[model samples]
Structures are given as structure tokens and as C-alpha cells.
Target: MRVSGLILPWAFLLATALFAVGLYWALWVAPPDFRQGDGARIMFVHVPAAALSIGVYAVMAAASVTALIWRHPVSDLTAKSCAPVGAAFTLIALITGSIWGKPMWGAWWVWDARLTAELILLFFYLGYMALWNAVEDQTTAARAAAILCCVGSVSALLSKYSVNFWNTLHQPASLSVDKAEHVHDAFYLPLLVMMGAFYAYFMAFLLLGVRKEIRARRIRNLRGALAREAGA
Candidate 1:
């Protein structure tokens, strides 16, 4: 393999361990929210998922750029590999956000900036996948999808900042990028664990998906070569 194969398995193991630690801290060690009580526990997963959705989108964008710039087959495969995972993360974020909203905001859905932008992102993902399927040629499909991926990345950025750019039902960022706070070390430690777990999950899935795509491509090449030899 051109990539670090060992890293994926190690990442999977590390992620599992982190997830276990995070769950323990969130459920047992960290104190419940003064306001939301036990319900606040949901944030442990929701926030991480939401953040990851955006982060993965950024990765997809970078991969798309590489695919177009370097014309690297692996880059295209990696970009294509990320779509489903990104979509899954986005779905998880939306569902958890809705659930959190119902208890906190008294509504299941809203046309707020963040929510609207996120929904648009979901559509963009679907559209990009559809475009890939519509094209018959792999090169053509990769180019088209790369464009769509790059263009669609705008929505991903907007999704992250929508809460701040406009008034929205979604809460602002949990940990400020600008300022630091004395978050209870217990809570911070677990938050790190969960974040690491989520990242590992992304890597595990992305690597597996790319590996499958590479295998299929190799098979196609072999079949084409055999057919050519027979014809000759």
C-alpha cells in the first residue's frame, strides 16, 4: 500500500479506547449541567459530531483539490471515499441537534441559519454523488465530482459559522477559538477523548472505503487488459 496501512488499525484501536474513556467522563465524572440536568449529556456526542461534519467536509475539499491538481488516482479515490462518511456524520449531527432542540428549544425543526445551511450541505452531498453516477467515464466522473466537491465546500464553511453570522437556534461554539476558559479538567479530558475517537472513526472508514475503490479499479484494469489480449 502507498499509504500507512498500519496506522488505520492502530487508529481504530486508539479511537475505541478514547471512546470508552470519553463515555466514562461524560456519564460519570463530569457533573451534569446546572440547567439541562441529565439531558446535557447529549452534548458530549452532539457537539463532536457537528464539529466533525464540518471538519470532514474540509478534508474532502483538500482531497478534491489534490485530485484535480495532481491528477492522482489515490486522491480522487480518497475524495470519493469521504462522501458517505461525511453524509453520515452530517445526519448524526442533525438528528442529535433536533433531539437536543426539542428538550431545550421546544421545537424539532427551525429555518435557522445553521440548520438551513447544514440541510443544504446534505443536498450538495447527494447531488455530488448523483453526478458521479450519471457520468459513465471514471475520469470524467472524477473531474466533475471534484468540481462539485470544491464548490460544495462553501456550504460546509457556512454551516460552521452560520450560528455566529446570523441569529440562529443552534448554539455557538463550545470551546472558543479565541479565548481559553478553565473548563473543568475532567470535562476537557473526556472531550479530547471523544474528539480523538471521532477522528479515528473518520480515518478508519475513509481508509477502508479508499481501499475498496482501489481494488475495484485494479479489477477493472485487469479485465480490460484481458479483453484486449483476447481481441489481439
Candidate 2:
């Protein structure tokens, strides 16, 4: 916990630095795409948000699994906390994707496979959170919510592969092949920096969420003990 606490400040600072440098580079230093022109700048933020949206769901699902199978209260709290974060990231991805889509696809939205799957993924996040809130008993809610998370993981997978598996206006991943990013030399650095920033941002948020959930659980336990004492 102490290690994670120390990492938090570094993560936030790194994310801020990367974002500052990356955005400046993306906006000014990077040349316009021959095809997409300046509109491609959206990818800098949109791709990170989209990628992390899927990534966050995986975190939620895994934590959900541990919460259910092992009855780990911390896992349950972590899973529940991640829902809002994932939802927020998903919303960012959708809005930016839509902005990019308007000029490129000639429409603000389309029935493309990737787009459709991502939309469903967002719905899943919302549903998971709603389910958690609807239940009053924490144990029951955790179990029920975990089931939903595990089930909805299918949508997350579909979203990740929709671009490769089907015909879509959404372009293939730019960061393929690790060393060789299919983009121009200028765009690659900024894109990579943005990706790093996004990753750091995710880690920082995850730590915060875990810490918050842990504290909340502690408070609840204390209150429960107090109630028992008062009754005695």
C-alpha cells in the first residue's frame, strides 16, 4: 500500500507531463495526414480513451471474479469503484469517436461493428453500476454485480476485435508491431507519449479507487461494530 501511495504522485506527474508534451507535439509538430488532414488529431486522445475503456472493463471483470469466487470484499469494492471510471472513459471515447466520425464517415454515428460493440460496452458499464445500486445487501449486490461483469465481458471482447473482424470505417490500430507504428515518424512519438500518459492515468485512478473502497469498507465495519455495541 505504501509503494502504491508513493507511485501515485509520480504517476499523476508523469501523466501530466506526457499529456502536455504529447498534445503540443500532436497539434503542432505532427504533420497533417494526407487523407484525414487535421482531423486525425482526435486519435491522440480518442484511441487512448477507447483502449482504456476496454482495459478498465477487464480490471472490473477480474476483480469481480475474485470478489465472487473468493468472497474478497476488497475485490468487490474495487470492482464497484471501477464502473464509474470505465463509464467516464467510455463516454470520452464515444464522444471523440463521434467527432472524428462526423467529418470522416459523413455522419455523427454509424452502425459499424466496432462502434456498435463499444456502444454496447458502455451500456454494460451502466447496467453493472445500476445493478450494484439497486441491491441493498452488499454481499448480494457483489455477487449479482460480479455475475453481470463476467457476462458482459463478452461485449468488451467484441468491441476490441470488431475492427479487425469486420468491415468498419474505424481504422485498424496504429500501434501495431510494437517497434513499427504504421504512422509517420512525427506522429508516432506523440501518439506513443499519449498512450503512456493514458496508461499512467489509468494506474493512478485504479490506486485511488482501491484506496477509497478500502476506506469505505473500514468505515462500514466500524459503524457495524458501533451499532452492535449500542444494542448490547
Candidate 3:
């Protein structure tokens, strides 16, 4: 718990530093894309959000598994905390991807493998949230929602491989062997910094959400205790 307590403040500091460096690199240093021109700046946010959206789901799913296997309350709360944040990130990815695509691809939307699978991933997050809220019993909610999370992981996997599996407007992997240095040095550095910032942001938010949930639980317990005392 002591180690975990340190994560919040450190995450906040890390996020700030990364975001500052990343913005400088992305906006000032990176040259305009020959093809996309200034519009390609969208990649910094779009790629990181898209990548982290998938990663957050993985975290939720893993926490769900731990909750069920170890019967840990903190694990359940952490899983619950992650779902909404993951959903928000997924939405950001979709929106930014559309914005990035319109001028470049000449279309705002496409039913390609990557897009479709990512859409499905969003729905999965929503469904998990709904399931958790629908149940009145905490234990039952955690167990049932955990199962959904595990099942929905299939789509997450599909999302990762979708570009490879099918011809899509979305470009191939950023780190492909064929295109080791596809992006300019200036852009690459900032993009990496942005990615680090996004990760730190995710951690900070995760811990914040967990703390809020814990406090809510504590308040509920106190309320229950007061009611018992009043009855006595």
C-alpha cells in the first residue's frame, strides 16, 4: 500500500513533464508531413489515445481477473474505475481519427477492420459499465462484469490485428521493419514523449478513481453503521 500511495503524486509530475516536452516536439520541432501537411499533427493525440484505450481495457480485464481469483475488493474497484476512463479515451480516439481521416482519406468514416473493431471495443466498455451498475450486490456485479470483460477481450485482440488482417484506410504499424524511420526525427521524439504522458495520465486517473471509490465505500459503511445505531 505504501508503494501504491506514491504512484499518484509521481504520476501527476511525470504526466506534466511528458506533456510539456511532447507538445514542444509535436508542434514546434516536427516538420509538416509532405502529404498531409499540418493536419498530420493530429497523430500525436490520435495514436496515443487509441493505443491507451486498448491498454486501459486490458488493465480493467486483468483487474477483473484478479478480483475474481483473489476476491480482492480493491481489484474490483480498480476495474470499475478503469471502464469509464477507457471509454472516454476510446471516444477521443474515434473522434480524432475521424478528424485526421477526413482530409487525408477523403472520408470521415470507413467500415474497415481497425475502425469496426475499435467501435466494438467501445461498446464492450459501455456494456461492462452497464452491467456493473445494474446489479445491486457488489460481489455479484464484480463477478458478472468480470466475465463480460474477459469475453470482450476478443474484440481488443481483433482491434490490434485488424489493420494487418484487412485492407484498411488506417495505416499499418508505426514501427514496421520496412519503415523504420518513416517519420522525421523531430516528430518521432515528441510522439514518444506524448505517449509517455498519456501513460502517466492514465495512471494518475486510475489512482484518483480508485481513491474516490474507496471513499464512497467508506461513506456507505458509515451510513449503515448510523442506521444500525439509530435502530438500537
TM-score versus the correct structure, for each prediction: 0.93, 0.93, 0.92
For each candidate in the order shown, give its overall lDDT on alpha carbons.
0.84, 0.88, 0.88
Q: Which candidate would rank higher by TM-score, 1 or 2?
A: 2
Runs of candidate 2 with Cα error greater than 4 angstroms are 178-181
Model 1 TM-score is 0.93
| Segments of candidate 3 deviating more than 4 angstroms | 1-5, 176-182
Q: Name the lDDT of candidate 3.
A: 0.88
Question: What are the per-residue Cα lDDT tens digits for candidate 2 across 181-218?
Answer: 47776777788899898877877788888888778778
All candidates: CA RMSD (Å): 1.8, 1.6, 1.9
lDDT of 1: 0.84
Assess candidate 3 and give its TM-score to the true structure: 0.92
On residues 1-232, what C-alpha lDDT tens digit does candidate 1 reach at each position? Answer: 5565767788688878888988988899888777887787787888778888888889888999999998887998888888888888888888988998898999999888899888888888788778878998889999999999999988998998897798776777875544475245555667767778888889888988888889988997999999999999
After TM-score superposition, what is the CA distance of residue 51 in candidate 2 from its true location, in Å? 0.9
Off by over 4 Å in 1: 178-186
| Candidate 3 lDDT over residue span 127-163, tens digit each | 9999988998777988999999999999988988888
The best-first sequence of candidates by TM-score reads: 2, 1, 3
